[model samples]
Target: MESNDELVDGMIKAMERLKSGDPALNTLASYLYKADHRLYEYLDKLKIYTELEKPTPQQTQDAGKLLEKIVFLLFKGLEGLQSVKSFQSAGPQYDLLVSGDDIGWKVVCKTLYLEWENRDIVIEAKATKSPLEDKQFARLCSIMEHNLRGAGLGIFVTLNGASGFPKRDSTRQRAVSDCRLRQIIFHARTNKIIVVLDKEDLFQLTKNGTLIEILIRKIRDLSELSGLPTTPAEQFQEIDLPTHLKMLYHSNG
Candidate 1:
């Protein structure tokens, strides 16, 4: 199992690779907002874990100090970011209109694609906790129909638990069906919405322990499946427990 530093480094490497020319750049470029939130949360968690009285003094101090350094570097990187959507489009003034008639909402998505070959892809990234709301989904479907000629795709990417539908259950199935019906009514042209959940994916941070190891493994699989290059994704540095954190672990000594 890898550690926290490995995970952050992997994500950074993946971002660099994506920038170098990952087709999914379409989706990856807009993930900075969620990434920022995750990193920030990690910093907070480390502080709390260190301050807990149950841990030995050494462990507490080591984890806290290491995490503090990580936090500092993250903020430094964040400060350099122009906006959450800075990497979305090639230049300023680029616009992809997403509007719906029945939904009474409009959004100009960053890095939106109206058509890809014979299909259209309307992409939206939102920070809301409820991406499945009727109005919101309706707006997305309507926008696809009105703007993309109904034959494209609707992609909603959200942070935390916002973008995914609930797991299937007898009672929940009814609601899901209703939502599908409403989506059809609004879309009238296209029939699919691809939702991506960042929070769901965040499990990799803890489960794999190192961000890079998990990401590298996932990217390797994806590359094999999609025929994308895995070199850059595999080139990241290994995770190291920061000096402060190691010190905390040895504090009792």
Candidate 2:
């Protein structure tokens, strides 16, 4: 590792540049650097990631890095969940993997605690601006099945949401339909859950509920939509959804 003096000097220089380079980020950075660093209060830090996100049709290295950072913050900031490890390309195919435990009992609702406790959470990111295609989603499933075996849950964090529609060719809706069909198959075969969330969904979630609460809702909603119920159905209770999340959950279903 570099000398401590070098690290401190680097931090000082980076802070100076941040103050001059980006006014908004400079403000956030100062707040974080000075504050108590409590995770609950730090939840607001998502603003930085949202501000930096600039999706393009062509994927860029910055897009992937931003997403990885966002997901890492989410797993750590959300009440009750704990991040066990994160892998960009070093671990499995997962971007960030968290293991849910009872530690969330203090900060999360009891229902969420019981559901997620002891389960493994897997997240995959797509930085491109286009909706996730069937093939792309299938890759996530394949990874979960073969690589991260026994992982209880999976999420697709996409910029443009997932594709699945009816009566269309491979362009849009048809791609969505294929993804849904695969979801059903995967759930039936493995009895696990995977859901998709676009950047907009992430933004709305910041308003609807705590990070973990919204995630619970999304997981159950996906399980219900798949028609292989019993678990998500009986265990899930009705809660008013933010209009955006409601619409995005299963648009063509």
Candidate 3:
């Protein structure tokens, strides 16, 4: 069995190789592609070990934290490579203007605008250890549209895996229905939603290259709200993983 130390060392090496553009970058990419699969494998084994037991509340919380960390890391990695500015905006009225009647109320416009090559995106990072409901997902979408009009993208980082949930599962469906593959136009004018599912769901999707292409294409399109072309290669070129990872390591050090 690979010891935890061994795994850590291997991961560090892989990340470094990727940063240096080593020929081994290909291998590292393959490994990352399987990350969700390995995570699911471990989860399945854990499920077997706890056959008669349900995950405790505290255990669920811990699991949620772990998943959140993974999503955060993924975003950080991608952000590093891109040439966009991203920072947490003020508060609820991050963007847009809301108005009531003549003597009514209005939310101040956003600090950022949807200018060419400059897009504003709001990210809501959340975690769930169990099945999620439709109301929760719908609520997220509503918040994005109502408050952030020129918002080009809305990303939902979810843990506790959304797979095994049915399509007819109104809750799961609603969670992502706003951006179905066929409903492309609707997202074009508004925030294109991206649900980064837990490790398990990500793994299953990898079995089909087509699915990966679809997701990349969708994200590419969403990213283009800044007047960029919709291309995965171009998007990645915009990501600066090497520098970002170095900063992360030094900060922790």
Candidate 4:
């Protein structure tokens, strides 16, 4: 039985190899993907165990913290990322703060791009079974609006997705309404953006490595829909993952 530390070490080594442009990037990525799958399995098992044992609230909170750490590690090597830090002192702070260069924003020529040099991204992680509530979104909006650090983006990550919204809405009317509210809040602050990344998005990122681009596209789309100026999606950089790995992962489908 491989320990979690061992698995993480393997992932780190694989990520390093991937960054080095090794020919075996596909193999390494596949291995890392499997490792991530195993991680989720373990988390699921833990959840079952906790259900049976009736874990204390503190124990449950600890489990949530572990999940938060996992997400922080997964985002370590994203392009333009300068640093990722988990907040320790526990009074009214986001779960994670991922600081990075605003290169993508600049590429899009969004308003106030020059002032957005250091892109402080606040991430709120919800590892519980419950979906994210409207209050959480409201809180995130407040933080982004008032925080002196000047965050340009807020990401709300959840295991189940947003509360009161169906996961697969055929009409997309709910999604559009949510995006409109987000756009209103973000633009009211001028140049700020907020997005929700559910478990599906996380899985897609692990499987395809295009999450960053997707996030940028979401921001651009929101800006355009709101009548704000933004660069065309074609102008953004092309960041295709290794073809072999993508095929390998999608082979079953």
Candidate 5:
């Protein structure tokens, strides 16, 4: 049951995209298109920071700040998740608390004494020349474990990507350390999950509004590892979540 006026409004909005003349571009679809372009722009800037051969300390600092904004903006822009960000006096930690009503997953779960509940997600960024190594990952773990009270999930955003298996050309130490720390958090006894995302992942997110979807896949990747039999570390490398998404729209010629 729909009113004629309301139905007409819907028709007009739909026709906005079909119009051959100058489009107002104020519809929801137009909004999303603009958002995607903006995200890609940010992603390009981040990649530029990584290209400098010998950036001054200040340049590095600026890149890190940009990463914070990118992380906040990308997660904040996600459709389903409700988020709040605060960069506190204790260094450049951008804290985002994601509501679980829509993103209900074990990766973001917290114990409510008698049962499990969706826990807040913490996002942190470390934009380095190469992917972050063991030292950085370990430090983040310690900070999250001790200071960020009640949080069980953390998303670490890096410039390059997470360390890979033995065959991985990067530092092997980082790969081992990442897995060790993950093991600690993934244990049934503990209820925490850490997801690491690189610049590529963010770029992919820019194309389609799939930040939350990529996170879910990543969460499941680490979570499911615990239930299955242990696999050698050399087998794993970074994951490419998704590149682009297109919807189906057909018309008569």
Candidate 6:
């Protein structure tokens, strides 16, 4: 079996080769893609399944941390990208930070709500079994409201779609109302917007080099929905991994 060091070194080399515009970029992309797959598998083996009948709080928190780490690793080698786990700013510690030239991401995982805080792009991650909820939508609005300077965006990522928990119909309806309210508030206050990424979005990101495009498209969709003007071309910038190095990093099972 390859040691951890060996695996990391190989991934680093593959990333470098891909960045260097090597003619064999596909081969290097494959290597990095497989590396991502292996990481996902390793995470799965950690047995942090949220579908458990009864999971301890510690287990849930640990699983969330591992998920954050996996996201950090996914964008680690993209050009002009830098990522940090458990990043601490002035207010509170974030689960992950993905920052570069023109963009910044402050991520939180497994949390019920995020208070009105700093202005970095906010991401809320949920477990595969959990669904996006109205409370979470309210939290995203709070974060967007705090971003008065119009430099931040709110993203909610979940392994499933909207929740059908407790009261399925009521929960779903409340979530929709919250989303509409968020759009109005965002349009009136800041240039920021909120969007959701479900399992399909994650799958596309891993299967293809579409992270940047996915983000930009979502932002555009939000802008349209809110009746706000379209985002400028300059506002959208590509990060670490280029599109040409298309790769797959998600697990099949």
Please report, in order, the local distance difference test score of every candidate based on alpha carbons. 0.37, 0.53, 0.38, 0.53, 0.52, 0.46
**Candidate 1 wrongly placed segments (more than 4 Å):** 1-116, 160-164, 168-192, 196-198, 202-253
Q: Candidates 1 and 6: which is better by TM-score?
A: 6
The TM-score between candidate 2 and the true structure equals 0.56
Q: What tens digits encode model 2's per-residue C-alpha lDDT throughout 1-253? A: 9996566445444443332224332222211111113433323443344455563433366657766666666555543354467655654455777764443322232233223332676788776656778887788788778777756678887665666522212222212256777777887887777777666545543321334444555555554563321122123345446688888865886
Clash totals, every prediction: 12, 5, 7, 0, 0, 3
RMSD of each: 17.0, 15.0, 16.6, 10.9, 12.0, 12.5
Please write out the lDDT profile of model 5 over residues 1-253, one tens digit for every residue.
8996466456444543343222232122212211345666777887888778999999999988888778777756533345475657475454555544432222123111101342556777887777667666666666556766456667778776555412223322323345445434543445566667776666666643255445544555554443222222222333322333212222233
TM-score for all models, in order of appearance: 0.31, 0.56, 0.40, 0.56, 0.59, 0.51
Question: lDDT tens digits, residues 158-196, model 3?
Answer: 444233232322331222232232224435555345343
Task: Give the runs in model 6 whose Cα sits over 4 Å from its true position.
Answer: 1-39, 42-58, 83-85, 102-120, 147-151, 161-176, 226-253
Judging by TM-score against the true structure, name the best candidate. Answer: 5
Local accuracy of candidate 6 as per-residue lDDT tens digits, 1-253: 9997577455544444232223343233323222245454635533436457777887777766666655655555333344334555665444444433321111111011112233344566666466676676776676546522332556666555444222212221223244555554665575555666654455444432344445554554444442222222233332323345434322243
Off by over 4 Å in 4: 1-63, 88-91, 101-115, 163-166, 174-183, 224-253
In model 2, which range of ten residues has the least summed lDDT?
27-36
Error of 5 at 206 (Å): 1.3
Candidate with more favorable, higher lDDT: 1 or 4: 4
What is the C-alpha local distance difference test score of candidate 5? 0.52
